[model samples]
Target: MSNWVEGQVKEIKWWTDSLFSLILNADVEPFTAGQFTKLALQVDDKRIARAYSYVNAPSDPNLEFYLINVAEGLLSPQLAKLKAGDTLMIERHATGFFTVDELPASEQLLLLSTGTAIGPYLSMLVQGDVWQKYQHVHLVHGVRCNADLSYQDKIKQLQAVYPQLIYTPVVSRESANLGLNGRVTEVIKNNRLFDLMPHCVTPSNTQFMICGNPQMVKDTTALLLDRGFTRHRRREPGNITVEQYW
Candidate 1:
């Protein structure tokens, strides 16, 4: 890892009391759509840093990060307090291979995520490569409440522009007219998710990209494996690519 590079905060978009997106102007090496970078800030005289996935596409001039303010977290609380013109530290290199190009060619692409894990998928969606390769794309975002479903309008706008794109939001806690009311795993388990896709989300025809809560990732991965999907690896490229949000 490289020493931290300083970047100036360009903007901050707070979607809820605890969730927000940060935009920074930084110069760094190019990275793939789903790659992540380290962010740091001085707190209590200590340089606190954490890895965050990029929300902006690789082509974007500004770097964007979707973050959650954990009441007890050391870094997030400080990150949430940042304003435009504030200095933020970032790694010189972007890292991770959680991208669509890692998977084999498929007819359909499914992006499953929860909470801020939707960040990386949003980066991938804005890139032309994903749409160019797959005939259909499905993005499912799951949150505890409808209010936590950030970037909903942006996703819907993408859906409106792309006939092959399907955007489904799932709320697990409260009844939401904006989205399906259920856990994401339950929605997938009951075939409610597939109903929204233009093509059947099958192991043979679709490639799965899952990111978010570790437990949800574990359960969903197990479910997919049981139904015949294979996990991607260097030696054997498969139907599913996963990134667990810790």
Candidate 2:
């Protein structure tokens, strides 16, 4: 059977000129924190589809997704104009390789993402799965500005409730009382991820999950590998797991 499920758009909120959010009424199918579902759309009596990651955790009744608006793109262009009571389609099955399950148990877990790519990481964080498996959960999200730093309250709450969880927001374009500033890879290169930790987070005990731009993943993966982190696989376990946002 096809994995897609039919869903309706209960609401829409713009995050930035090129970013938006969607809320749907669907009992989320059972999924790991870093999985994604394909969203189907209809245009002029023809049905089409686009995949989006869940930004909300399973504990939440309403399914939420953070989206990036491609101004010239087909689905996103139409999607951005939608309002509550609008119609859409969702797949029943969700899948991805960037969840905690891909990494072996470790002392420290780093969740790295940028832009809407932070969606899956947020999903995993709110699921309460990382806290159960690791002693330290560090979430590093890179954006262009403060407005791009979505889920501010959610991240703060999670970190506060779970003292072991560390939330770090990195912005590369704008600064000035806007929290940490720099690209995710640049921060890792500049020894920033380690700076936020109360103690050193080393490759010997740290497992990383990276998402967002492919370049970000590549650079961060290269850095981690140099520090002794490995790319995990079905059989062989490694320290770094990446999900390409596109």
Candidate 3:
């Protein structure tokens, strides 16, 4: 059984053929910037629930989420059809440890994500508190095409406020004439990411937070471990934190 509260669908933003964002108006429990909450809708006799990371800052007036529309997904396709007056089920409490606060203080924080996985990082960015802990913060977002780079405008706004924030949007398939062109794992391995940064991205001075496709998460984690980065844990603090989005 789940304790779910109803939230009004305040708005919807469709970014591309497969991507969209939902804004829900509800009074939610105060949550950490990078936590996620479950959204549900009744389908026939069953309640289909899915977890989505918040794109809005914890203090933002409305709850926002970025999502990918899976044609066959039980919930996402239905979610795509929602309108302003529709109601959605939001979990009473948010949950997840994929936040900057969970990592040890470091000189630089590298946030790596792909597709809608960038949602939580966006929340952390807009909250504007990560700037106080680390001198430098870098967000590397990977997508298949230029059209999929959804939040450049928002990132630009944040960069204006925090000059230390660095954003690198990577297009893996098409050459966008924008940022880098390669898988984020390859970019990090080949030293291309550091080339654009002010400081070196080493295990000693950098903490890595990775969120994205399962394959990307696995591949990236393997690469980082080989380079001496350890996975973060409750008892043993290390240089890497990861969340795999399905």
Taken over the whole model, the C-alpha lDDT of each candidate is: 0.89, 0.80, 0.91
lDDT score, candidate 1, position 185: 88
The TM-scores of all predictions, comma-separated, are 0.96, 0.93, 0.97
Tens digit per residue, CA lDDT, model 3, 1-246: 446889999999999988999998886788999999999999998999999999999888799999999999999999999999999899979999998788898899999999999999999989987887799999999999999999878999999999989899889998856889999988988988878878877778988899999999999999999988999897998998999786
**Mind sharing the TM-score for model 2?**
0.93
For model 1 the TM-score comes to: 0.96
Summed over model 1, clashes come to 0
lDDT of 1 by residue, 122-227 (tens): 9998876898779998888999988898997778778877878888889999997676889888988898888888766677798999999999999999988988
> Which has the greatest lDDT?
3
Query: How do all the candidates rank in terms of lDDT, highest first?
Result: 3, 1, 2
Which scores higher on lDDT, 2 or 3?
A: 3
Better candidate number, 1 or 2, judged by lDDT: 1
What pairs collide in candidate 2?
3-92, 4-91, 4-92, 5-90, 5-91, 5-92
In order, how many clashes per candidate? Answer: 0, 6, 0
Model with the higher TM-score, candidate 1 or 3: 3
Superposed on all Cα atoms, the candidates' RMSDs to the truth, in angstroms, are 1.4, 1.8, 1.3
